[model samples]
Target: CLGDRAAVALSRAGHFRGRTLFSGMLYAPLVMPEVITGLSLLLLFVAISAERGFWTVVVAHTTLTMCFVAVVVQSRLHALDRSIEEAAMDLGCSPVAAFLRATVPLIWPAIAAGWMLAFALSLDDLVIASFTTGPGSTTLPIRIYSEVRLGVKPEINAICTLIIAAVTVLIVVASLAAKLSKTQADNAAPM
Candidate 1:
């Protein structure tokens, strides 16, 4: 939700001053080293006296992944025909209503893709999670790393297999859903 809103704002930012500067700042995390990003987040948390825990980890991951999501969504938005949304508005729909009813459906695929990307990044993230996580908030990657230091175990292999299986299932489901949605839309269209 946050990422989509950011993408919309940034995509429309071309009409505003300082667009280039704002865009560069927003996308800077893509090129910045993970260590640097993690460190900066840690410093920010400390400065604000925020406890390093699950919520902090969530915030950290969101901060890191939102830009990627924005990029994906912005690309889809760029490819989208604005006339469809405009037409909805022309037919007495408020701008917000038009965006929700017309624009959102058209961009749903990109939103889903962005969400998957963000989930994957958060799932495997180590550095940022490490920096932000505290007691009782150990993430899967951090736990795996700690366990591996003592020696690899059969449980580790099992866990890895489960993770792989889960990801594969998620991908298959997403693709199937997309295909089903497309089919439904096709069938619903007028001849």
Candidate 2:
């Protein structure tokens, strides 16, 4: 939520500050290894004298995933036609009102997609979570890794299978939702 809102607000601000700096930050996480991101975030936490706990893990995950969300949202924004918002404004809506009413509906699918991506990344993340998480904050990926370190068992396989099935269902649902949104957007367009 924060990532999408921040990206759109920055993009709306102007060219240089928005396009260059935010774009660079977003791509930096993509290129950097997960270990490096984890280490850097750990260092940041240490510097701030913050305790490693659930909220710390949440913050670290958000920081790492927001860049990905920003990139996805930004690409969608770029592909979005500005003319729609302009037409809304011409119809007597304020700029903010036009963006909220005319623009948001069109790009909502992309936002949802980015949010889901961020969520999935956070879900399976072990490296970063290891560096940032404290006792009692163990995530599913960490648990799976631990189980894998022991010999893989039938129960583990069953659990893995269930996770795969869940992820598959999520993907199918998201795809259908995106397609529905696209159809609605098409229907709403002026002839």
Candidate 3:
């Protein structure tokens, strides 16, 4: 939803294509060191916070997270069936109506999966969060960092275990949901 808007805005403005920029921004942190990503975002956060306060963090997070969202969403869009969309249009549906009704429903699973993955990634992201988070806003990864730096503790281990568990759960849930959806689609297919 937001990625499409950003891409369109960029396209209309002639600044840069959203797909290229979004892919670059999102991949930079993932490929780069945590310190670099964190430090860069930190500097950005500091400047924005000084100028705007709490909302700055939100903006920063969005900038960082939207890339991942874009990648996932883009993949979903690529896997979508264009024929269904064309058929909808031929059946008297407007282009917009076809997209809203036929296209969106078919791609809904991928869109949902992408969003969920993005959200989970944002939640687990240490480097980006460290850089982008304000002084008063520390996320779970930051808390873990502080604890580990100070000394090893059972609570830290417990927290780490929980994070791993949560990630595993999310992956399993997404996988199962996708599998079920695929099965349903296959069963409905003309055989």
Candidate 4:
């Protein structure tokens, strides 16, 4: 969340050397191979002497997810109207207050989409989790892979189908809710 917000702030700033540098660094992770990311994370844990476990997996996934969120939010920020934030500040709102009251509410759909993308990526991740996970810290993807190695089971297909359906339903519901709220707000607005 912080990364996404920071990306928006930085991207909104006028073009500069530092912004260019930050954008390069931010997008670099997206192009990096999963194997390299996994290996690098494993090394970092080993170097720090941090115990590899659930938290480590969580950290690794969060790192990966942040990059994705940053991308989504940046694009949204680019298409946003800067005048709204300026108007808020001109109307006596502080810079921080302007962000919270004007910017955030308008860009909420993008933030939500980014969050959902991050969640789905984390859920489907296997390569990074494999490197970061300790014994007994297996994820669903890992478990499914292991099961596939033994033999493909019909029940596994059913479970995968159910998971896909659940995710699809969640996405549909969220979209419908967002649309309903927008319609309500529009109806309540004065001409």
TM-score of each: 0.90, 0.84, 0.69, 0.86
For residues 49-168, what per-residue lDDT tens digits would candidate 2 score against the true structure?
988888889988988898888878877888899999999999999999999999889888789889889998998899999999887778788878888899898888998899899999
- lDDT for 99 in candidate 4 is 85
Q: Please write out the lDDT profile of model 4 over residues 14-131, one tens digit for every residue.
A: 7766777777766766999888989999999999999999999998898788888998888888898989999999999998899899999978878988898898999999999999
Residues 1-191 of candidate 3 have per-residue lDDT tens digits of: 67544433343345554656655665564466656766776676566556433465556556666656556656666666678889999999998898889877866665676567667766767766655666676777678888889998999989889878987998898789879989999999998
Give the range where candidate 1 is weakest over 10 consecutive residues by summed lDDT: 11-20
With a 3 Å backbone cut-off (N, CA, C), the pairs that clash in candidate 3 are 42-131
RMSD to true structure for each model, in Å: 2.0, 3.0, 4.2, 2.5
Better of 1 and 2 by TM-score: 1
* Regions more than 4 Å wrong, model 4: 13-21, 178-191
Better candidate number, 1 or 4, judged by lDDT: 1
Whole-model lDDT values for every prediction:
0.91, 0.86, 0.67, 0.87
Ranking by TM-score: 1, 4, 2, 3
State the displacement of the C-alpha of residue 98, model 1, in Å, after optimal TM-score superposition.
0.4
lDDT computed for candidate 2 = 0.86
CA shift of 58, model 3, Å: 2.8
Q: Rank the candidates by lDDT, best first.
A: 1, 4, 2, 3
Off by over 4 Å in 1: 178-191
RMSD from true fold, candidate 2: 3.0
